[model samples]
Target: MATSGGASCSSSVLPCAFSRHYLAVCAQDGRLRVWNTDTQSLHREFVPSAHLSATCTCIAWGPCRASKEGPQRKKRKSEAGPAPDQQPDLLALGTAAGTVLIYSTVKGDLHCILDGGHNGGVNSVQWHPEQSLLYSGSDDTHIVEWDLQTGKTRCKWKADRSAVTSLCVSPDGKLLLSAGMTIKMWDLETKEVYRKFTGHSTTVTTLCFATSRPPDSDGLYFLSGAVHDRLLSVWQVRSDGKDKNSVVSFTLTDEPQYIDLQTADSKDKAVRLAVVCKDGQLHLFEHFLNGPCKKPLSPVCSVQVSSVGAGEGATPAPVTLLAAALCPDRQSLMLAYGNYLQPIVEKTQINTSERHVCLVRDVHTTLSLSVNAAVSKVKTPIVNEQKGKVLIPGVPGHQAPIRASSGESDKRKKGAGPTEMSIEERLEQVELSTLGRKGEDKGASASLQTDSFAVLLVQGLESKDSKILNKIFQTKKEALIRNTVARLPPPAVLPLVEELSRRLQGHPFSAILTVQWLKAVLTQHTSYLSSLPDLVSQLGVLYHMIESRVKLYQRLTRLHGKLYLLMTQVASSNSSHKVSDLDREAKLVYEEESSDDEEASGDEGRPEDDSDSWEEEEDNEEEMDVTENKENHTEDEEDANKDAEESKANGDSDMDPENESEEE
Candidate 1:
């Protein structure tokens, strides 16, 4: 499978998995594309015939070993195995036929196929980091473990009632994590569920362990993202009684399709977290792998993976992301996206289905400040108690700088020179002065003129923070909601509606607030929004979401009423022997009254029988008039028949005379 030139997946839109040295891609055409990470070139390609015509669904790469420098390390490296590149890095490809095809990249051939363990299509596959074992999850709701050497299944157990969509193994190879409708941690020794994590509201599709362990913490950290829930959660997999298993969670603006973790090149050993979302955007974060976890982790930066070439003000052509991986450097990202506009069969003989991977550079360096740098840049202030002053490092004090004269000597009059301050003192004074100047704007806004709550609400609506948006909707009154929506910018109107639609789904308790916001925005901008194509599309999506929610509520309500009726009947039947005829009649009367009350409540705003009476009267009068008309028509037809008969007799006599004359 090794090749010198660049290569891409031609007929594949399945998942891509990468190791330290290689990246494996499963394409729709039942072929596997493995690329060398260091060289950024195609290493090998495997054909679909090897998989027996089943389409690839997911892929996983075997762990590759890295080299060390010290003599002791060198001795261990020599004994560890072959060099990383020469080693037969295994690529496990899961297919829709309930089988796993393990291919060795160095050998460029199909190594083995693990089958018969699953009865349904395979959804995810993962390799043990240190052991020669492979695990796979399928639609059959079972997780199967396979021994790589024997090429046979070792054990299989039910992971979830729903299909397992993702799998992740711990670095120590003791715990296995499977995600479907929820996330479950399994004990490898017992082959039983240790605990379940229910952080995600919907299906969890992706899971990844942190690149390195956190300092002072024995628990293993991992990340899980739910595509349908649009949420990402960081969890610690340990039975530490003092700490919570859940470290932090984030609500994403878009559904996350993939997540990759890389160790940042810093002294603090921060982790570089990259998330590929459904909106064609890649969100990057520099988080600590050593310190205490914080709430509300925000991305340092977001990169548009799909709209790389789109010009300003132009709608980008739709592209489907097949796979995304972090480069070996961790500062670069490899994005594999499909161009739908390009024809599969071109006029030229060459196939344009494959293209070079889109490499996004400086993913980590693009942050404004590194985590270590930020910590180092901030210094504790020094207080001079004798002088009654607080002197902060890198901050300027109230003193001004002294300008030296060109002709004057260094030994000028000390009193005239204002007792020359040391260089450090002058630097501190300068820093303090700069910071002080920046704070003057607060005084300007301290006047009566200030930003209105409506403006603040608009800012919150435009913000990417879901917390702020949720809080505003949940706490603010209807008047403020209306005012804020009225002040929304033209470009932000569509997005506001879209956000409200998503909020309504995840936070049904906020549905009333969401509806208020939606009503105000659409009512205020009805004319302006109707002219935009994007608005039309967004409104269509919002309509569908609201319709689905309405249907679900209606179905639940009907089910609840049926259950209540059944319970009431059961209770009544259980006590029927103790009740007399009078009690039964009274119970029936109570039911009738309750039903009548419900009907009255349902028809509260409707007019009384007057409207129905008028409609009924009109219908009866029209029917009576129609019957009278039919009777008159029958009488007229009879009269016309008699007149016609008389006319026929006269005409017959006249004709007889005429015929006689003709005969004569």
Candidate 2:
């Protein structure tokens, strides 16, 4: 646990089980560590291999037995016996040497090693939902299914031409999902590909299923992100061919490192997806897959890890975020930065009038300190005075009392009250500040001062002024755009979408902002818009415009790339155009000499007795002609003689038989 000024725990794989009881992390130093939820301490640690060079590459915790229980099982088992009380937790750690080590948490012992299948480093490992089968993907571009009971490979197949980076099993245990160069779904029984999705433009490194399916959704919802791509896609796993279309694709400012899906709130209805980006920010998205939404998924907020524990205006040290997982309660996120594990909690501030106010700015202080505090409360080790031998805590009826300081109790009491204003209140304060600044700038311009962003936007749409609308949206934030759209009358939603779409045809630079506003309006009034039958034509027009704009942008991007390449070539040629006249003359002379040498060699290699060869060929041709004529003359003579003989024979036959036979 001691380290130098800077060191990173290997950023390989960090997996939190469905039950959220344990979090398993692998390090570059070939160490496998497990952290417990209850104790919040290092539950156990072990090296995956005895080889000093072995490095852990990926980790997977088996599905908890208790999570398999549901209403259907309860109804079926009403007449049957009760289930077992506990099952040992199984952990699978894949190493860089193409070896997989399985261990049991109950006994903390190595169970088996699966090393015969992969010839390259293992990239990912996933557990089957309802069986003892384990699926592992390796850099060899092969997926191997291992039977845990017998410690043997049950099946192995090539998943992709590229290394399979991530794997997930469907909840019903009927399908297996793999991602690498492309996303593919496979039939668990036959191992044939069910469907292929080419939505992501780069290599996909993460795949996760929603914690729970939203009732409004028709298929199993899941999330995928590529480490090299700046977009996160929400896809539906359907038995029907509707899986080709992704539910939504979210654009981000930075490439995503990890994605975790959980409930947005205590209701467990809305699906919340948290994407941890390489830029050290956690992007939170809500209500993306729960309802009938036709808009793009946008992040509600982004929390920066470095800013969480830093004081106001103090520069925070940059840290590389490797992975993130939501705790079971959805109140805290565990972030892995190199070798350090940090917990960021969403502190709930209780207001007497309002139920709760979330303050995200006060979350991180290192979970290691908490672990140390917990260890301290457990009492020191006991030693025998007679033999000076060591003893474990609470083994010899030594129950030490836990003492709490008064200041700690007081601090806990004060923590319950609200210490800051809510988001709405902050927005109102910002609005006031903005108004004050505007009033100071334009005291005599009453009309301009009276109109707010929403008013200006509504007026622009009513008058069909594209310039006004574009100017209004040029400098606004996403939240401000959404708020402005929400302030519009319900009947104006269609006009907003139409205006935004039309503007997109003219101004490609404002597409991002216009799309933001358009999505906000559509999302806010989805039910209202879907209820109207007469609006179908307008919606179609909007979709057509969006599709055309996308095509246009893609074409522009391609053209820009070509132009850039051409310019680069021109620039290089210009820079290297300073060839000296002497050098050019030498180059031409060398070329001329080489050409002359080639001509001389060509003449010398050719046969010098060309006339003699032609005479011999002519003589051979004449001899062949003479032989052909002689053969023809002989055949003609033979034919004439045969005809004469036939006539003589006929005459003889006639005299013999019919001088009697009328001389044949």
Candidate 3:
């Protein structure tokens, strides 16, 4: 191939690579040319169209890190399989005749022609390496996605105006960027037009995205060359954030007809700028990776060329830059020059290569490179040793979160949930089975009681009335339990409950009202409650009254539990107020109910009468050691139960749910 007038050599696409060692040029001549980028010499890669009418207008290179997804399979398996080994390095050529040809590096080899591509001229092509999608823009004003594996168009939709002219995929393959007069974004997944970027007024000539350091996680950034302003525009294509239109924009001096851009993995952050002129001139812009540059007034390197023109006003008159491929290491530059797409011109190579090192301050490097390295660095481990405050013990990764309980939890299991309930337990709440309920709990407020014995057992139970407990225990060998099933109190009772649950646990305390229950029980008051009581009952009528009263008192207990826990959690929780409220209430019961004469013979096991008999009997008697009667009046006590039963009927009218019994 040699130079003719070079006036109107209609070059379609110029594929330039600094790292690939070759300049790829696709021209209207229906031929592909490869040139050495650095030496401006010709490399061996070249391919020509099979038919005279085959004119390639666009070309894109496939990914180097080819998918392990093997050779392309057919709709039906072919007679013979291709060679098991295949390296994907080819020019995906888009032609004017609406067909695509896979041009390999080897010249004179049969090309893999993909026809039936577009209805009109295939103007541009790009490969999305990550998406495994091929984007081809055509004069049909559409971008078509080809199922490269199936050799068919996956989907096609209208894209740019005045015929789709250009396409580019991001390095990380997150976006498929295409342009004509306006930049249109197509989603990689659904191939839908996401957004149209319309900053350029004239036809867009070139498009490229900034590559992230890791070559992945590269976000939206594009460099576009436009004919309208003769300015190379740099835009940040942010899909997310306030600036969806354009986040940032930079302009170049020339009206770029053909432009190619790249960022070296140099990690220096500098970008490479290469543009082909309508006049046969090439201007190169080298950006250094040093740091942020406010503007491009001073670039790292600039190559101002006049190779095609001999004199000052010679006018290079370059038609189009079809392709420019550099070496794989970006150490060279190759150009496809002249009308015949001949003379693979090599350009002045930019010397940008620098020595790479593993960071100077790295601990591993310092440890390995030092001649006087510490013994620890080179020594082999024989046994486990604790290093300073940190312990790196070799333990097997096998242990349940719930091991054998040793701390607070152990006391609970051993103290509560025993095999059997004792005699006093008959007075307390106990469920028959955990398997399932045979009958619904209709006792009192059905909603009030849950399987709340669980709370009582949370780490064993504690109580303020140890003597009342010991005395009660003497009447029968029964279980001593904690009052954990108390309901939480409301905000009004928040201070009260906090004071009580805490005092109940903290000091010679008693139960009171609280915060959690106030919050918990808006309507479902019966959901969480105690199924058992704290004390053993000896006086039948009194025991019943006490059961009712204790149930009421424990309301504060449950409420206090919630409040205590809450106040501990919430701010300005007045727990002491609850303690005082309880003290006042306790005194009222003792003073109004007990008299000396009634205290002598005392209220003992009476019949299952109405609540007033217990209240009346409670008013008659008050003293410690009700357990003494267990032995003293075994026979008489059994007899008095009958009269109390008769009297219970007389006082049945006064029993109230709230004020019924205070013993519990």
Candidate 4:
């Protein structure tokens, strides 16, 4: 999909797209456009916010279309789905006018304007796949979820008393995360403020979520780089509830600039990348969320993708990843600058004579299909008495329409009324609808529409490999139970205990019952709920082989309780998208099993959530750095060993003494 190797445009608002071969741009004369680098064509342009008055700051494509339908069919077949639209279309766009607009990229036409969307300039806009929703946050210190299909505001809030600079909807569309002075997380379905993470020391400029399986994750596990002193971080989000060590962080190279992620099954396969750079050159880095940290953060090919190329250009200030479009074959990446204003505007004011504009306009003089000519034939001029000139061009007889500003709602914003209850007490309200149903479910499908559970069997691997995996999982199921019991979130542990109590009501499989109790303690507070469904299935399979239905049922019941905790955690947290992935993975396993069983009689699998703004995202990145390396190292070389000491003398949990001494 590579063109002869260069872009010719002189625009500043370049946004990177995921899964689309073309990238989009917000132009100086107030135009929104897209270019297909592979064909070197300035494909489409639209002016939804009007004139040269505002700079569009953000642009986002709808979630990968096929990804939204990933449940039943994918597990049943080994096939790729449909191709993306021929004309290409972006899902949402936000401008300096404080307007959030939705339109199809193919038509180059405006679909809807989010009326009374945000108070101040709109900074970011995003769409969730699988569901019909959209969200936007602005300089007004508010984030709102809008139903694009309805042109209605599902929910809106005035976040801290400051501007809301960045916005993100988790992969599952359950959490709406907005970062400003402090991070504020909302439960999308019921509109609840589950957490208010207070950690970033300054303004947060960029936010990205990591996937549990890598390569495919969104910004659910948000790592926000603050503009304050430039710190980058990761968070452990779940529906199980909020807890400590929630945020772990690390300082970055230059203001912890724009960051993105990608997942790789192996080196040859195209690795997914999401990047935001503070460098003029577009810096693309691989996001390896699942791999051990010692693995380097590789860059696929960082290049001078966008050049100043003469005219009003001053070496475009640090390029940021504003929007991304991935092509249909899923093999190409499209980068664009969707939301970048203040910097470009500052540079614009420098051209006192508009010499840069004249030069830029001259460069495009060859394309004679003029927008002004098109407007002249169909419209009238809107007069602005103060400027003594025309403001909006419209039909000859039609006047510039008086568009009324959204007056303050007497209803007051939801969740803003005086509250006599404590934060903890308000949390008990479980509509889990705190964030509002505005962000589309990151990706949706029939599999995730239910509440049952399923498992994923490794594909394309040898039987020996499969056996090894089964064995490792079998061992970990029991071992992990003992290891992490104390760390389980209380909400999860209590539900699991209740579930086990119900299963034992049958008065059978007492030995399995005891294992159930231990299981609850082990998985108490970890982000490892992604592993529970398989653990239970494996346990049940063992019992089935041994001819013990009672024990199998008892074991399954106990494991179910633990998973219920994870589901509930997702039901309420900023990381609900991860829960959605877990749920989708289960469907794959079950669908595979069902195919074989249906020939005889029967078979099946289940689904993923997140919570946040409670803990600063930067904090989690710190703990994550060490947690990965500590899993493998030289332990007893300094007599600081634990797990491997009996066989090789190495501690699996903490750093070695030599390293410890180095610290001293």
Candidate 5:
């Protein structure tokens, strides 16, 4: 498709106009074309034959109503008895030569032209849905409200020194939004600026108003996208016009060419926005405007308008989406790229057995190649050890190995022993070699290959067999499991952790190991886990279980300490009582011994002093022995008491105050 002079183009959809859908496209080529969307065929074309240099820069459809107090209105009422059942079809066209052409859709003829309002080319034109008033913005920096009935300008004002590029009206039809260097809201009745928003640092290119209530307040909000700044700002306008708030804003990656808001159905109050960027991509987003505080608008899907070919060795042609319109049925989105119009259809399917519903792009309607699919088609060849042989792994026909020459084969047979040669011959050499090791080096390679825990974990996960995972858990050490858990991808880690926890529940030692592995993983991946809400919640439950186990262990330890202290105190008291009894017995024995010795010495009047001395010496020896015995007994008792006391003191020092109180 070719266009005239590569002028900026625009398109709009007339919903159910003339009992059928129509798409109007203006390419600034001095001509306008209307397409029947249902048939995907051109319905009508308009060209200004008098103005050979004219170009249609913009176009808008008037509201589906006739003026109540105009001559045409009087003619319609006279013919249809004061109540016309149908709406009048009006189309407004803005040209580059400073003209606004109003045409009748039913008659396909020019109705009237509104000129002399702007001294420069018109940039944008919009019609009020509730009134017959038409608004136009021109490069003359003027925003003129034209009275369609009288073909006269009701009010004109300079919006800014720059050209007024875009215009939007509130759904209530009480305010007008004009975008030039900045966005300004004008009170329709007073023709005075109510609020001026100045966040955009560059020219404001396009503007749209949300059809649903804004999330922040019960008011109408408008969205504006600007060039150079790459910002999309949503501004809220209250009913009384006392407050203007910049509710939500988004920074687009690419400069947006056009932005449109569409509602799929009346029942679904949510609005979906279609943004066309300069990079030839169409982005679809769901605007969460009516639900909660500061709800973010999220991307629904995106499609490239043009694709770069792979292996073609040619530069892809640059394609830019100038305009887009959602059909009235909401099933198809039409985009204008250069002079071509493309339709994108929405496809959906339901799985009855699984009770799942999913949406997919229609394969037949897409005109551009998918980047992923195109990339997948490219194959990188791997060079084999033999020269000039390229092996493409995973391809069925490339599995065979290139045969070696007789000399090489003889050298291999001689180097490898007879047993190795026999084994290689008996088993498929190609299969074993393709597994990354020769038959003779299998034992050495196995040990080296098992070093990476990540490789082993991925291998087990990919097997999808419960027995393999179970075997791995039984054979692999806890440290290896921890390493694997730490290294696994986020999507794979959660399921594996859950499976390990379940399998290890019956065995406390294994469960403890699993808990340790999970803790290590959580410690290493705390930031990543926070982003996945469901996985974080699951991990939290597991952590709580582990914490309860730890608390139970601590309580048991405290109980053991208290029991030990009680035993020490009881042993010390018993030892002291035994020492007291032993001392009393020793005192009684000593007294009796002394009485015997004195009686014997007085009663016996022996003539020999030597005999008396010998008897006293014997008595002294016996006393010394008894005293030594008593001292030894006392020493033994003291040692036992000392040990018990020391143990009690040690226990007291080890025990925390809180634990001691709880135990008591």
Candidate 6:
């Protein structure tokens, strides 16, 4: 059979049928369209008259001559080989107006119209392969068998209380299966229900017969798919007087609209089912009809046929798949929906010979390489022996032997070396090296020296090395000691602090650094440190040292301030005293000058007047010197006070009692 590639038709295509040469499609607008599969083009369109303005619900093609029976069939041959006087293959179209329209495929003309077969819309129709009969199920809960030759209903029966949604005939045309609210099997000759299957909780919408038998038995099987429950069931009719049934289910991401089965290959008998869902996705499943397993249907994959374009956070629009047809070649599928028909082709498989050849070649190459490597290894000793005979021109013949014996002796000596050192010895060596001394020179390294503070701290804590511990405290770098102590675990930090304190006996600088280190560790690691009671108890000493230092610094600061105030007051008092003395001297000098002026006027050329002037000048010079010295001293005192104020502004003092108390 030929398949179309990239061919699609405008949608609202309800039901579709495929023959060898032509594809017939019924649309919602009461129109029937035919397509030529070879040319991938529309062949004809048949639109019903305006008086019959009802949607076409389903369609099917008449059986070819090969499948025909009775005396009238002798006049017809194959579907593509009708005699000159024979009629063309017929097309049956079921409409929502409860009428069945028969058209001529070749002439593209309506030949017969079978009306009043269904009271409500006909939902499904199927033509008998070996008889001039057509069966239809409708929403009015009726199944009608129509005689195409006479254009009349042969019989009518009620299949269910609800709408008869789908119908299928057995391979031998003896049994008919109808699905509605339940599935029922009817004996065509007797025209009576033979059996009823009623497991579905909702309406059964689709049915199809399987062409294969079950495992370890020869039996006919059919599948039923239902709504609301999203269940597909398999029922068997055996020839050995036994029947079997099974149900398979899956998570319904969306409501199932239609299901179609296709055999993978006619020779292999492997079947796969395709389901079109309302969520714009077509899901595929593999059905193992002849397998020994209980469940026969398994999910394979799904493909998205449409996409919601309303952006995120918006509900996706529902898609209704009206019809689907799988090509007999099992390579292409046709899906019908709103205004579109899409064809999907199956993926091809790799060639078995080419794959096997490449695999074998890779294995052969790898094996050959491995064999060559092993052979080379097996011959390596002989090759080395041959090379050993050749010697350099500068070397003596006996020298090689001597060197070989020496190498052997060295290996033996190394293998028989002394036992390994203990953990304490190794730690001691590391500590001594960190303290800027050779490990062997412990006596000469009496003075505390810290080269690597971190190594010294870790080794000292681990080995309890008192010498290294003392050096860590003696190190002038406060930051180095603080960082090393902080790196230690909370449990070890307190003991290390106690040890450093013990070693810091009379060294105030070391003791202060140790206390600062302890405070930093406690403050930064309080969460981990608080869990250790010993560490928390040891914190008392650190707090005490900090408080004492704070109090001492505060007292020293207060004393300094008081001393400065006292010095300034004393300087001011002295200045005032000197000013008073100067005032008195000025008054006395003024009176003396007036008296001298009068005496000089009275005894103008006396020798005593010259001596008195000289004496007065010397006294005035001495008084001026004393006043200059006092002013200089007062300026010095003011400069000292300014310096003290600047130091206080720069936070040079260890404690400010006001800020310290607030912090506490």
Model 2's number of clashes is 8
Per-residue lDDT for 314 in model 3? Answer: 38
Q: What is the model-wide C-alpha lDDT for candidate 3?
A: 0.47
Give lDDT per model, in order: 0.60, 0.61, 0.47, 0.46, 0.58, 0.58
Cα lDDT of model 1 by residue, 1-664, tens digit: 1111111111123466556456666543345677665655667877645323476887776655343455345566476544644443677878778989888776888889888899988888887867789999999999999998999999999888899988887665787889888888788999987767776667777777774443235545677777555567777655453334468665565777666666433336666666667665556666765435566776766554322322244333333443455544444555544321111111111111322233322221221122354346667798675778432211101111222233333443433432344567545545655677654434222211112344455566555676667666774466556656564555456556667766665545667667887888878888766554233234544654555457668989999999999999999987885565334433222122366544534435545566447657456546755776787799999999998889887764246776889889
lDDT by residue for model 6 over 214-333, one digit each (tens)?
Answer: 312544667776765455667655555345345344444555655566532232555666666554456666554552345444356554433242324533333334445555556556
Q: Which stretches of candidate 6 lie over 4 Å from their true place?
A: 1-13, 49-53, 66-88, 212-218, 238-253, 263-268, 291-296, 306-324, 334-664
Worst 10 residues of 4 by lDDT: 2-11
The Cα error of candidate 2 at residue 534, in Å, is: 63
Regarding TM-score, does 2 or 5 come out ahead?
A: 2
lDDT by residue (tens digit), candidate 2, 18-54: 2244556553333566766445567777766533344
Best by TM-score: 2
Could you tell me how far off, in angstroms, the CA of residue 544 lies in candidate 4 after the best superposition? 73
Between candidates 3 and 4, which one is better according to lDDT? 3
Give Cα distance to truth, residue 67, candidate 2, Å: 12
| Winning model by lDDT | 2
TM-scores, one per candidate: 0.44, 0.45, 0.41, 0.40, 0.44, 0.42
Q: After superposition, how far is residue 617 of candidate 2 from its true place, in Å?
A: 99
For candidate 5, the TM-score is 0.44
Total clashes for model 5: 0
Ordered by TM-score, highest first, the candidates read 2, 1, 5, 6, 3, 4
Candidate 2 overall lDDT versus native? 0.61
Give the Cα error of residue 416 in candidate 3, in Å: 99
Tens digit of per-residue lDDT, candidate 3, span 1-664: 0010011112332433322444565432334656555466555534343333456676566655443364434412566523322233566777778888776664534346666768888877777666546778888888888776777878878775578777876565666777877887667777777666777776776776644443222344556666645555555444352333443334444455455555555445556655555544455565544333355432233333222332244333222233343333455555544332344344435543332111111111211212575557566756654443422111111111322235435554566444233545433433433334566344421212322432222212223344532332122111111112232221112222222333332222122222222233223333212111111111122223234446657787999899888878654346655666664435324444346534645545545667657666564443333644565578688778877887778874456666656633
